[model samples]
Target: MDEFLEKVFEAAFKRESEQDENIVRSLPFFVAALGLVLAIFSQVVVRMPPVGTIASAFLYVLFGSATAIFSNILWCLFQLVRARDFKLPPNEERLLEWADSLQKFHKTGKRTRKAAEELAIVDVRRRLVEAYAEAAVDNRKSNRHKFKYRAQGFMGLVLLMVLASASVGVIFFDKTWRISHGQGATAEAAFPPPHREKRIDRTVRDGEAQASGAGSAD
Candidate 1:
């Protein structure tokens, strides 16, 4: 019975380990893709038209979200590195010792084992299995956390992409509107003409000349 249980535990552990390995292997590719997208979006933002306060605030939010997602990805990578080195519980060593003794005794064909010894072996095996099951549970919890972080990061990336795309659309739209309606000429018209300033200066000089003539005549 103990052997069967041990085999089951081993199989489950192997499956989990393989799943974790696959996740770790795929993370680098995901991180690289996200980073590339972020870089492209950053360039787009740089080329975007000047925005008002509201749009600038939105851009700041997008920047912060992207930075947080990048940080989360980095943290997940670090966690994967740490999780690769799994450590057994301290009591597991004693359980292994007991199992070894039982195996040796059986191999020697010893038929005079005490009832207490047999019970102790059974208890140790049960405890060992329990310990492994607990460890597996912990591993599963960690995996869930990894998934959650990745999901959040991806969501943030998507949001940033959407915001950047919208900003780009606005820029193109504004440019088109300005061109279609001759807004550029209107903007030029908004400024006072240079000739007006020259005329004002000429009027001031004429007034000063008239004043000087009157004083000379007096």
Candidate 2:
């Protein structure tokens, strides 16, 4: 009985320890990924022009994505803290004492195992198993939460990329429009209209006739 209980406790402890280690290792990756996303977002914002109606719509979407990413990052941080502080049942000391007693009994062979002590040990083992089971469930839940947040963060990143691309396209389109309009204005400035040219010719003829008449009179 003691051997079996010890095996169970060892297995449970190993499993929980591995889970903690995994969570600790994964936290840095999450933080790094989020930081990269934020940096890319900031670069995109810096290059963005003043927002018009269409651009405003894109900005709103980008804002929502940013909010989601940050929220997920906070959640991941909270989970990381919780994982770091994970512990076994509070009666762990009592269980360890029972295990020690059982060990000592097997070694000395001087005293017979009391029925009450055996029952108590059995109860402790059962509680430990239950605690381990609960911990396993919690670990699984935490993993699912991590996966969900990661997916959301990636989705936000995709949305940000789309927003950036759309903004660039709009900027290019506006620049082209301005260039075309400027070229049209320049062409008009370089060439006078037909009506203006005709008016100028008529004024010159009148002035020449007036000058000739004045000279004849003199």
Candidate 3:
């Protein structure tokens, strides 16, 4: 009964540990998502025009930054490999060897057999524990094989945003500028007469010219 209870408690503890591990592994992605939203609001939805243009640069920067974050994540996969097959520390190996020596007996054969089976179980648990720890590392980061795809995802979203903004600007402001130009033309059409005299008229006919010249010279 005591042995059964011990096994039950061990199983329960293992389950909880697994849950904690998964949460830890997922934290990076959660942080990335949170930053994404904050960045969008800060760089986008909150305002418009001149400032937005300046902020668009940030979209590109964010993608590059996210890639950098993911690259570090790839390095973590190596840690997982290390945990799985890499030699255990001295104390751990000694303990594991002791367990392996115990697995040689069958329960029906002798007391030693029971101890051996227990040892085997312990070895299995050891391997699983290593795997669990390795898996607990954050997965939101990108390895070299997966990096191109993540970069594409970030850049694609930014490009789409830029296009959407441009489309909206053309929709909203293009007509307004056109209307303003039209009104300016109409105002010029109604402008008052010339600011200065365009000509000074001097008219002289053949007979009138002859009389004017006869009096002028004398």
Tell me the spans in candidate 1 whose CA falls farther than 4 Å from its real position: 51-85, 88-131, 184-218
lDDT at 45, model 3: 35
Candidate 3: pairs in clash:
70-142, 102-116, 103-116, 105-113
Give the per-residue lDDT digits (tens) of candidate 1, residues 9-60: 7666666666677767767766776776677677757544344534455656
For residues 1-218, what per-residue lDDT tens digits would candidate 2 score against the true structure? 65576567657666766865665676676667666666766765654444554554666676676676577657646755553334455476777887777656554655455754565567667766776666666655665665565555556556645655555665566546646778535533444556868888899999999999999999
Q: Report the Cα RMSD per candidate.
A: 10.2, 14.2, 18.1
Cα lDDT tens digits, model 3, 1-218, are 43454455456445554543554465465457545644654553333323243334444454455455445444433333233222222366766676565465334455575576876786656654554444333322213223443344445445544544544454346335536778535433343224312221123355678788999987
lDDT of candidate 1 vs native?
0.64
Model 2 TM-score (2 dp): 0.50
C-alpha lDDT of residue 143 in model 3: 33
True-structure Cα RMSD, model 1: 10.2
Residue 73 displacement (Å), model 3: 20
Model 2 superposed RMSD (Cα):
14.2
User: lDDT (0-100) at residue 31 of candidate 1?
Assistant: 72
Output the TM-score of candidate 1: 0.57
Query: TM-score of every model?
Result: 0.57, 0.50, 0.29
